[model samples]
Target: MKKSIDYSIEHKKWLNKRRNKKISVTICQFAILIIFIALWEIAGSLGWINTFITSTPSRVLASIYNLYESGVLFYHIGITLLETILGFLIATILGTFIAIILWWSETLRKILDPYIVVLNSLPKIALGPLIIIWIGAGMQSIIAICVLILIIITIISMLNNFLECDKEKILLMRSMGANKFQILFKLILPSAIPGFISVLKINVGMSWVGTIIGEYLVSSAGLGYLIVYGSQVFKLDLVMASTILLCVLASIMYLLVSLLEKIVLKHR
Candidate 1:
């Protein structure tokens, strides 16, 4: 009974510490953002900065409100979000499978390593024109761009994680007569979950970038298209508003990945 009471007290103390830490971080972020906006407003109003080009936070907020009222913001946001999620899911699954295949075949991995590296090193955005031409300039092109951007990164991250698996544990499994498939499923894949989560986190931003670039190149709808349209019309406020919305969406996706990491790591 005494030990149980002590454990309860310890748990409470830990919880309190965590709560305080979170509060501190939140306050710090808000304070910095407030300071930045204040300085930006003052500078723009005082003519120290060009409001027409740079755009102030207040103008951006107003633009957001206007866009919201028109019901156009949600339409673009939804399309971009859909493209990002679809591309992320496709790239992650394919990348994980490729990593598993490479893990199992040293000869194949050796033969493909150089090709993978070359593909990864190439600038993905440069392929935008070709992708649009091949995919016919629409959601398909956007998803294709996002998938291309994410797949190589995911494969590289997962391959490294797989290679770094504990040799002793793998040897023990082998000594027990575990077959290749059993060893991969029971050991390699489980060990790489954390790395997979990390890849997802990275791909969240990349997916957004890919979709936006794709939209910029060729799309009738999406946040990127909005930005392009705003720029063509010389509406800096609209561009700023669209950019902020994109940032918010990417941040939300990143937070989801972070939550997944916590849940998966807890079981580990």
Candidate 2:
């Protein structure tokens, strides 16, 4: 009874230690961000850095306030956010489905392997003009660009994960009279959960990148549009403000993905 009680106490201590460590790391991250902002503000005020070019934190905030007052802040954010989310969902679902199809047919996989590699290697930017022409200069084009950028990546990552499933375990399942479909659901899919989560994480970043790039090419409204306009007009404050907003949005998306991962893993 005494040994069991002692063991429980030790386990609690270990868990507490881990919790404290996580807290400390989070605090440090916030502290570093605060310190960096302070230094940036001080440097700009002292003329140690070019405020006109870099834009101080205060100026950036003021620019954001101006956008809010004009009632356009959320409009631009919503545009970019919507595009990113749509692209992410479409690419993930389509790519995963295609991967499964490829995995199920060895002949199909072999036939498409070279083509897939070629598509993956092609520069997405070179196709941007064609995308604009094909899809037209609209939101559809933006989402299409984002999807094109992410789908190939998703296919490659997921296909590799599915292919890497344990051959021995598959054979054992076969010996037990399990069909391919049963083995896949009972083993392959379960084992690929981690890879799927990883793919989600990658998609979070790629989604943003693709959306921003699309906006750069043909958007009339979005954070990327603001960036392009700001740079053209030399409105450094707007550029800085838009950039900060992008960072915040991207970080929020990534954190949401991480939270999803935690939930899935817990259930797993």
Candidate 3:
């Protein structure tokens, strides 16, 4: 009938609009990158910006090529990626457990909420040295830093999300003779899916920050180490190249998490 035809038209419009928006966003991102790079290269070539300190794109590429030729490129990349992934996964798991614990106990939640806020606000870099001293350097120290940065934040964030779930629904479940564990598993966790995915997105960035900071403190290898060494030796090109590579790697990681989010959204 007419109503069905109208509904079909509206659906088509929605689909087309969504498709256009996505295409525009992607195009904008690429355009911005290309424009910025072109500007940077022009400025460097024109000596409007000091290429020695700013480091031109050509120099960065040459440095990367050198690293690739030396066979140290993948080694450092792999180390940093491994550390970042390990920290991200472990922090997510630990944070989930802590969030659940906080949600389960009113007394504990009251006691710990302020502490979690304080810990999250504290600059993690200030503790990097202490972490290195305690963990005695290496990948363990890097991971510990990541966990420190991510876990409390995750717990605080997700616990708030858990608290925001529909109270009426919880009450109905309670009336139906649902125990705490049953309610948690069936309703609370399911409701918090978006929050958890958000946490994953956040953790992706935090993982890199934590790993790089940790490497700055104690790593003999990895991108952070390369950056530190490059600066010490006045090799600005290498520093810039390492930083650009970090950006690329982090973007790839974020894209993977975004893909996961899409899958989760579609399934839901």
Index of the highest-lDDT prediction:
2
lDDT of 1 by residue, 1-268 (tens): 3454656777878877989999999999999999999999999989999999889999999999998899887888999999989998999999989988888899999999999999999998888899888869789999999999999988889999999999999999999999988889999889888888888888888889888888888899989998999999989998988998988888989998999899889977
Worst 10 residues of 3 by lDDT: 1-10
Comparing 1 with 2 on lDDT, the higher-scoring candidate is 2
lDDT per residue for candidate 3 within 199-259, as digits (tens), equals: 9999999899989988888889999999999999999999999999999999999999999
* Residue ranges of candidate 3 with Cα displaced over 4 Å: 1-29
Candidate 2's error at 135, in angstroms?
0.9
Per-prediction TM-score: 0.88, 0.89, 0.87
Give the Cα error of residue 129 in candidate 1, in Å: 1.1
**Backbone atom clashes (below 3 Å) for every candidate:** 0, 0, 0
Give stretches of model 1 more than 4 Å off: 1-26
Preferred candidate (TM-score higher): 1 or 3: 1
